[model samples]
Target chain A: MRMSKIVRFSADVLFGAILIFGFYIILHGHLTPGGGFQGGAVVATGAALVIVAYSYEEVLHMIKKAGLMLQESAGLVMFAGVALIALGLGTTFFFNYLANSGLLFGMSVPFGPNPGELNTGGVLPLMNIAVGIEVWGGLAIVILYMLSGISKAEEA
Target chain B: MIETIIHVLVIAGLVVSAILVFHFRDLLAAALASALFSFLISLEFYILQAPDVAISQAAIGAGLTTAIFILAIRSTKRYEEDIP
Candidate 1:
């Protein structure tokens, strides 16, 4: 069932904020406490809020299952692709080849206890983002699928 | 002193919420109690300086799980029936 108008409005407002914050956590994983899984869970929670606030049909219109599945598969492929690239570079899989190599996200860290640089951590940020995307898609899809199942059962 | 007091209070609240979850016959109220327990646990994690874990717990456990449970309740019975 659909919620009250006020609840829907609040959910939309909160969803925007949570989405931004979750991305911030993912992007800053190398410098912060939160990484891919945590940030992805946060984003999925925001999506869940929107899902819960709206009816099943409304939610399906807002978020397509096919799109979410594509995102999840793409994220997994991207994560593995990064690891494979390391092997192509003649290093071990999941190697941090870009660090201090003057490439994207390649800045080296200082000795100790200093403020973190956003550009550091080699392929760590990339991996974080990939995992974040995967998790967000997977979790939101779980909730969405469950709702769909419930609706189907109701119709029968 | 205050930190210790806060810790004690949080722990007490956790116990109360956990018990309330088991005590409630209304599944919805029990779900809310469980959510409260998750929230308190997340708060404890934050106090322990594990913000990442806290955020995940708060979002997934307290927020998402509660929403899912509520949805399930909507599709089924809101109150538990006696087995016997």
Candidate 2:
């Protein structure tokens, strides 16, 4: 069931802002308060707004379930690979292997708020990104699947 | 005093919304009421100075959970059967 025009318009208007805010939270997880799960849930809420406003067929065109499934799988694989790489490097699992070592995503952050370095927090930020991707894909796919399932049930 | 008043109001709203969640015969409305309950609980978490938890609760509890409930309700009956 499609909503009123006003609802659809507002949803479209809010979607970009919500997506940006969610990514901001995800990237700044180490420096800021919100992390992967929080940011991902926020993004998923934005997708929910779109899903609620449009019909199932319209939503399918907007969000591909197969793509979401692939995204979810990729995110999980990347997260696990990132974590396991620390072990392969002869460090414990999920070690701060990149912190202050001048490797990729490695920079020293001082103790304070708003340190102003995006290239800090070592592998933590990468982990946050991986979790964010996994969560965003997982939650959005669940909503899309539920919508598709309900429409099928209605048809049968 | 102002903070205390805000806290009291949020807690009261939480109670009211929880009761409304149980009282509504319409499942969609109940899900909405639960969302309101989640929002109030999130507010309470903020009052307690846990902003991160508050954000998670507000997003997952108030937002996504409500969407999931609404979707489930779409598949089944909207209204509950009255007890004899």
Candidate 3:
């Protein structure tokens, strides 16, 4: 069942902020306490809030399961591809091949207590992003599936 | 110290909320109480200096889990059936 006007309005307002913060957590996973899993979970909560605020048909129009399934697959493939690339580079799997190599997200870190930059952590940021997207898709799919079941039962 | 007092208070509330969850005959109320329990535990995690665990718990434990429980209740019964 959809909520009242205030609830829907608040959900819409908070969705963007929550999504941005979730992305922040995912992007800065390497430099912050929150990583891919945490950020993705945060984003999923926001999705749930929005879903709950709207009718089932409205939700279905906004979010499709197939799209989310593809998102999940893409994230998993990206994670694996990043790991496998290390083998092609003649390094072990999950290698920090890009670290200190002056590429994107490869700025070398001096070992000390200091402010961290986004352009570091080699393959970590990519891996974080991959896992984040996968988790977001997986969790949101679960919520959608539940709502689907409810709608089905209601129809019967 | 202030920190110690805060920890005690949070834990106390956590225990109380847990008991309320068990005591509630209304499943919806129980689900909400569990969310409160989750929120308190997340606070405790933050107090214990584990923001990662805290964030995950707050999101999954409080948010997603509550949503799932509420949906389950909506599909079925809101009050627990007394088999006795």
Candidate 4:
């Protein structure tokens, strides 16, 4: 049976809030304690809440596995691409070539243990976003796929 | 003194919930107890100054795992079968 209206409404509200918070954690990884994996899992948890609130068929209509898989693949490719770019730049793998370049997300971190600047962390922030995307798609898909498999097994 | 008290209380709660998870005969109740255990552990992580671990635990351990377990339980029996 579908969840009650109150539960569904609360889930809907939480859904948006969780997505925003998760992205915030990812973007602020350099400045905060949370990073890609944690943020992505948090986002997937919100997706799981909405999925559990509705019937499998309804959830299937709302979220597509193909799209999630594509997102995951794209994230992996982008992460690798960024790493590879460092190599092409005559630097070592995963090198922070953009740091202190005064470019986007390339500002040098302040010396010592003071509060960090948002635009710092060079390749770290980019990698964090990429991993966040990958984990978000991968974990959500895992839950959806498991639920679908269980339901299908029950029907047999 | 207050910090110690809170730490003790959280640890006690963790122990209780973990025991309850195994003590319950109803599968659903056991799943909920496990969720409680997960939440308490996440709290412990937070108290230890690991917000990142706390967030992931709260999300994956307490949230996703509980939902998946509930869904799995819903597809089958709610009570444990006695071997005797």
lDDT of 4 at B70: 78
Worst ten-residue run, lDDT, model 2 chain A? A107-116
Question: Best by DockQ, which number?
Answer: 3
Candidate number with the higher TM-score (1 or 2): 1
Instruction: Give the alpha carbon lDDT tens digit for every residue of B1-84 in model 4.
Output: 999999999999999998999899999899989999999999999999999999999989998999899788867898999899
Per-residue lDDT of model 3, residues B17-83, tens digit only: 9999999999989999999999999999999999999999999999999988877787787888888
For candidate 2, lDDT tens digit of each residue in A49-89?
89877889999888988898998898899999999999999
The DockQ score of candidate 1 comes to 0.81
Candidate 2 deviant stretches above 4 angstroms: A112-116, B77-81
User: Over the stretch B4-82, how does candidate 2's per-residue lDDT look in tens digits?
Assistant: 8998889888889889988999898999999999988988998898989998999899988888887788778999997
Better of 1 and 3 by DockQ: 3
Candidate 1 to truth, TM? 0.95
CA lDDT of each prediction against the hidden true structure = 0.93, 0.88, 0.93, 0.90
**In terms of TM-score, how similar is model 2 to the real structure?**
0.91
Taking every candidate in turn, the Cα RMSD to the unseen true structure, in Å, is 1.4, 2.0, 1.3, 1.5
Clashes of 2: 0
Against the true structure, what is each candidate's TM-score?
A: 0.95, 0.91, 0.95, 0.94
TM-scores, chain A, per candidate: 0.97, 0.93, 0.97, 0.94
Off by over 4 Å in 3: B81-84
